[model samples]
Target: MLRVGVVGVGNMGRHHARIYSELSKEGEVEFVGVADANLERAKEVASQFKTKAFGDYRELIGRVDAVSIAVPTSLHKQVALEFIENGVSVLVEKPIAESIESAQEIIRAAKKNNVTLMVGHVERFNPGVLKLKEILDENLIGKVVTLTAKRVGPLPPQIKDVGVIIDLAVHDIDVMSFLLERNVRKVYARAGSAKNPLELEDYAIIMLDFENATGVVETNWLTPHKVRTLSVVGTEGIAELNYITQKLILYNHEWVKEAKVQFKEPLRNELEHFVECVKKEEKPLVNGEEGLHALMVAIKALESANKDEAIDVEFT
Candidate 1:
C-alpha cells in the first residue's frame, strides 16, 4: 500500500487527511499520520483520523512515501525541500511558493531527489473544468476570443500571507493558461486594499493577453457572498462554468445546452491523482514547471498593479 501523510492540518490540510484516511480503509493506501506547528490542532485532527500526530513535519519525512504540504505560502519551499531531500514525493498546495525563485528551488530539489512533485491546483480536477477542457479540445467553442473569471468572497480569516492576486487570482490565471495552451504575453492589473487591509492587497482585477486569446480575472476579499465562476466566449458560442456547483452551460444562436458532468469532490480527485502518480512514477497534470509559470504570472500581476502599467511576462 502507498503510505501517505499530511503536513499542516489547517483548513485545506484537514481535508487532505480525511481523504487519505478514507482511502486507507479501501486498502489502496495507508494513512500514516499528520503534523502541524500547532500541536493541539494536530492532535485534534489526528484523533479524528485515528492516526498519529507530530509537532514537527520533518518527523514524517522518512516514514511516509508521499506527503501533502499545505502550509502557508512562505513555508512551502522550506517544508517541501526537507521532505524532498529525504526522498519523499510531495503534493504542495497552490501558488507553489511566494516567489518564482523559491518555486524553482523546490522544483530543483524534487528533481535532484528524483521524487514526484505535484502542485495542488485543485480547480483542474473540477468536473466542470474537466468537461470544459474536453469541449475546447473538440473545438466546440471555435477560436477562443476571451475568458473571464470572478472569484470573490469575504476575507478568509486564515489568509494573511498573500493578497488576492496570489491567493485567489492565481487559480484563474492557471486555468486560463491551461485552457489556452499558451503562456501569458502581458499582464495589466489594478489592486488595492479596501476591507480587511493587511500588508498585501485584498482586491485585484487582472487582464491577461495571450497569443490568440485574452483573459480577465476579478478577485476580492470584500464581497459578502462567495462567487466562483468563469465564462469563455469564442467564435462559435459562449460557455459558462460555476466552480462551486460544478455546472457548465453553453449558449449559441440556435440552442442553450447544459452539459452533464459527474460531480466528485475536487480534493478527493486531486489526492487520488497524486497517489496514482507516486505509484506509477508518472508526471502529474499540473507539474512543477506549470506551477512555476503560474507563479511567474502572479508575480507579474503584482508588479503591474504596483507600477500601474502593463508588464510583459517573461517565461524561462
Candidate 2:
C-alpha cells in the first residue's frame, strides 16, 4: 500500500483531504496523514480521517510514499522541493509556481530525486472534457479554427501571491494547449485589479494565436454569477461545454443535428487517477512539464498585457 499525505486544508485543500479519505476506505489508497500551517485545521482534518496531523509538512514526508501539495502558489517550490528532496513523489496543485525559474527548480529536483511529479490540472480529468477530447481527436470537430473560454466568479479573499491569469485562466490555457496539441505562437492580454485590492490582477482577457487555430480566454474574479464555459469551432462542427453543469453539446454534420451529453463528477475521477498513479508508480496524465508550460504561457500573457504588445511564446 502506498501511503499518501495531503498538505493544506483550505477550500480546495479540504476537498482533497476528503477525497483522499474516501479513496482510502474504498481500498484505492492508504491515507497516512494531513498537514497544514494552521495546526488546528490540520488536527481537525486528521481527526476526520483518523490519521496523523502535523503543523509542518516535513514531519509527514518520511511517513508517506507520496504527497499532494495544495499549498499556496507562492510556496509551491519550497514545500514540493522539501518532499522531493526526501524522495517522496508529489502531485502539486496547478500553475506550478509564480515564476519559470522556480518551476524549473522544482522540476529539476523531482528528476534528480527520481520521483513522480504530477500537476493537479483536474479539469483534464473531467468526464465531459475527456469525452470532448475523444471526439476532437477523432476529427468529429474537424480541424479546430478557433476556441474561447470564459471563467468568471466572485472574488475570494486575496491570497496576494499570483494574479488572476495564473490563478484562474491558467486552467483554460492549459486545457486549450492540450486539446490543440500545438504551441501558442503569440499572446496578448489586459488586466488589472477590478474588485479586490491586491497586487494581482482581478480581471483579465488573453488572446492566443496558434499555427492552425486561435483562442481567447477571459477570466475575472468580479462576476456576479459563477460561469465556466468553453466553445470550440471547427470547419465541420462546433462543441460547447458548460463546466459548471458538466454538459457537453456537439454539432456535427454526420449527425445533421446537435447532441448533448451529461457528465458525472470529475473530482472523484481525478483523485482516483492520483491514487492509481501512487500505487502503480506511474507518471500522471498531467505532469510537471505541462504545468510549467501553462505557467510560461501565463507569464508571457502578463508581459503582453503590461507592454500593450503581443508577446511570443518560447517552447522547449
lDDT of 1 by residue, 20-68 (tens): 9999998878999999999999999999998999999988977899999
Give the lowest summed-lDDT range of ten residues in model 1: 193-202
TM-score of each: 0.99, 0.95
**Reference-based lDDT, each prediction:** 0.94, 0.86
Which residue pairs in model 1 clash with each other? none
**Candidate 1 accuracy as TM-score:** 0.99
After aligning candidate 1 to the native by TM-score, how far in Å is the CA of 87 from where it should be?
A: 0.3
Q: Residue 108 of model 1: what lDDT? A: 96
Instruction: Report the error of model 2 at residue 311, Å.
Output: 0.4
Clash count of each predicted structure = 0, 0
